[model samples]
Target: MLLLNGDEVRKAFPVTEAYRVVAEVMRRYSAGDVVQPVRTVLGPGCDGSLFAAMPCHVTGESDSGYGLKAVLHAPGNTNRDLPTHVGVVVVFDPETGQPLAMMEGAAVTALRTAAASAVATDALALPDAGDLALIGAGTQARSHLLALREIRRLRRVRLWNRGNARAKEFLQWARTHTDIDIERMNSPAEALCGADLVCTTVDTTEPLVSAKDLAEGAHVNAVGSSVPGKRELSADAVASCSAFVDSREGAQRESSELAAPIEQGLLPADRPLPEIGEVLLGRHPGRSGTSERTLYKSLGMAAQDVASGFAIVQSAQRLGIGTMTDFTG
Candidate 1:
């Protein structure tokens, strides 16, 4: 089996290539060409960490395979200066069911999640949307900045993070990766006001963004809250926009961003929350007009990780990256 570390995974699947791979995966998933069950999340131990098992299989694709990503989400890791998400993704041959490769899951999640957002933003945001408002300064924030820049010409970035030290660290990190001017904001409202594109990547249960602050033509990628009970956007904020999701089933089961709005009757219970895939497939008109607000609720899926991992394994094979070993010595 091939073993890939975080750096190797990142090198094998850059954000640009990740965008294309994830987009195709989403399309196949929405078209019922992929088989993925809803992920099982077990959690909130004494330390408030959670573990999840996400698995999927893709059919009718050149890189069809079975993949399982077992991950631990430990928010407290920030205090320890470690990543909050850490785990491994294992890939199995579709035809023979033999384990083929194992790779770092955090890298895969970071790459594919941001790439999925970029896909949604491209399909739902206005053609020229550029100004960005980022709600958190974590790893996901950094990845989103890089991925979004590939699709849109960013004019500036407004950032808000709970910790000033972390925000400063992120600013320094940004200087090396991007030339775009980023302003530090004291509050979420300050960062979000009139921004054309907004991303919320913080780990929070309470709302940080409000509908009152969003511009008419704004597009939001709500990335932080994936589970049912946690949320980052106000109910009104979600209700005010035309919402899209990575998967309708996943969103209905796991998205806190949509749950409150749906329960409060702000977003009609029967409202159609189209998948980003549907938008990509041209089955749904993502943004009705320039004046309409659009929101993409992302609940990361197993199919994405599987398809992405399959692609990464293929690329590493051709490029001679990663360590290859066999257990049957």
Candidate 2:
């Protein structure tokens, strides 16, 4: 088995390359070429964080492979000055059923999650989008910024967080690290108003972006809520937008952004819903016009984990980066 640490994985899979790989994976998914089951969640309590397990198998295009990803979401870890997400991925050869690699899961998750958003944005967002809005200042928010930068020519970014200190810190970091103009907003409305692209990365039950604040040509990526009761987009926001999802089965049960509106009758049950894979496959149309509002809700997938794991493994081998060991018994 090849063992890959976080640093090694980072060196092997750059964000740009990860985005490309994820895009192709989504295209395959859209065309019904991959097998990805909805994630299974194991939670302890209402306040207790949950653990998720996702598994997938991909064969035909490359060496047949299967992978399992485990994620722990302990929000309270923030108080301990630790990351809220931690995980790992284990890959096995399809021909032998032998474990092939063990990889750092946190980095893989961040890259694939952001790359998934980029894929959706590439397919759904308007080509001329310039202004961007980000809700939350966590790792996912940072990843979103990096991923979108690769897909669009953003000129300005507006950031809003529940805490002013966090928002200011992120704004300062953006100014120091990126050339784009960064503004710290006092409210979600201020951050969203007139923005062409909006990314919601918070894990809150309340709606962050109001429907009235969203521009007509806006494209929103709601990445915060992957659980049943956690929602960040308002019913009005969801109802008024033409929405797409990474997976319909995942979104219907796991997406709080879609569930809120769905429960309120704002989102129609009969409306034609298309997966991101279908969009990538050209079976479903993306954004119709610049005036149309589009929303992409992602509930992170196992296929993404498997795809990214495979990429990291291939890149590591090419770069001669990891230690190979035997895990067959």
Candidate 3:
């Protein structure tokens, strides 16, 4: 077995490159070329923690193959000065089911998750889009800042968070790392106004974004709220947009971004919520008009982890990075 740590994973698969990788996976996914089961989430431990596993495989592609990601979400880790997302991704040979490599999952998850949003934004957002609104100041917000830059020439970034201290720290970090002008906002509405690309990365059950506040021709990447009962967008906000998902099945089962609205009779079940992959594969048109608001529901698919794992392993092999263990012995 091979081991690639967080540093290795980031070096091998940066967020900028991960966008291209995720886009390819999405394309294959829409064409019925991959096999991925619904992610199973268990827990609300005594401490309100979560454990989940995602498994996926490609059918014929020799490049992007098979893998599984085991993830743990510990909300209390913040107090312990550790990353909230703790996990590992295991790659396997599609033909033989042989263990190939294991890499740190946190870096992979952050990078690929944002990269997928960049892909969706690139496909769905207006070509001249520049402003970006990120509705969280956590890890995903930082990743999205880096990933979105590759897809759009961001002129300004609007950041909003419930904690001003966290927002201040996040802004300072972004200012030091990137040249984009970041404005720390006190309210979600203030952060959302006039932003062409919005990414809701907060963990919340209540809606933060409303349909009335959406900018004309804006595209939103609702990347947070992985649980079925949590929603970041208002039901009206979701119903008004041309909605897309990473996986329709995954969204229907794991995320309430779509399910909640449908269950409430807000969005028509027959309204054709095509997966983002369908647009990438040219099977469906994305963004019907310039003024249409588009929303991408990213539940973070297992296939994303599998594709990224394969990519990093391949890159690591060429770069002569990672530690190898003789599992055969």
Candidate 4:
């Protein structure tokens, strides 16, 4: 068994490499090459935090295997100097059922989530899109900024967080990571103003981005609030866009961004609007017009972590990065 920590996971899987694997994973999932169930989330209840078990199998690939990711979402972890997401992914040989590897999942989740959003944005956002608006000030927000840089040549960045001090702290953090000019905004609307690309990473139970505040032809990555109870985008914002999702089955039931409007019959409840995988596979044309709004509701999947974790372990092995423990017969 190979044990990898968060830093090792991030070191082995760069955003660009993560992007490549995620693009392949989504294509495989939507094409029926992978088998996974909707994750089972058990909440702390008192704090609305939850833990989940996501297991999946991937076939017809060099990394074919059964993968399991046990994840904990601790909303209060930031206050305790811990990651909001903490987990481990274990991969086993499909034929022999022998364990292959184990790696940290928080870094895997952050990079893969950001990469998935970048894939959608690259497919749907207008070719000329430049400016960026990042909502929320946590790990996802920071990772999205790094991942999106691979897709868009960002001209300006506007950031807004409910915690003004935290947003300012993120701004200072950004200064050390990249040379990009980022302005901390006072409000979500102010951050959204004239932004061509938007990534919402806030933890909210209600709508935050309004349709009226969105710029013409803007592309949105509705990333936070993965479960049924939490939401980030307004129903009007959902209605205004050509919506896309990571998984049709998962999004239809689990995406807070899409669930309400879909349940109210304002948006399609019978099926998801269309998947980013479909767009990636060229089964559908994304963004019908330059002036059209586009939204991608991202619900994190087990297959994503598994596929990404598998790739990360492979990368680490090639680089001799992790502790090689012997689980010998």
- Candidate 1 Cα RMSD (Å): 1.2
Of the two candidates 1 and 3, the one with more favorable lDDT, higher being better, is 1
In the range 25-128, model 2's lDDT, one tens digit per residue, is: 77777667778888888998987889998888865576337889988988899899888888899888767888888898988888889999998998898898
TM-scores for all predictions: 0.97, 0.94, 0.96, 0.95
What is candidate 3's TM-score against the reference? 0.96
Report lDDT per candidate.
Answer: 0.91, 0.85, 0.88, 0.86
lDDT, candidate 3, 1-329, per-residue tens: 88999999989997767987899888888888989888888996598789999888875554567789999989899899898889999998666777899999998999999999999999999999989899999989999999999888998889999997889889899889888889888799999999999999998999899888789899999988988788999988898899999988887777777776687898777778798999987889998898999999988888888888988998899899999997778
Model 2 deviation from native, Cα RMSD in Å: 1.7
Residue 236 C-alpha lDDT in model 3: 84
Model 2 lDDT on a 0 to 1 scale: 0.85
Clashing pairs in 2: 1-325, 30-277, 30-278
Top TM-score: which candidate number? 1
Q: Point out the higher-scoring one by TM-score: 2 or 4.
A: 4
Spell out the clash pairs found in candidate 3.
none
Q: Which stretches of candidate 1 lie over 4 Å from their true place?
A: none
- Runs of candidate 4 exceeding 4 Å displacement: none
* Global CA lDDT computed for model 4: 0.86
Model 1, 65-98: lDDT tens per residue?
A: 7889999988888789898888999999777778
Question: For residue 303, what is the lDDT in candidate 3?
Answer: 85
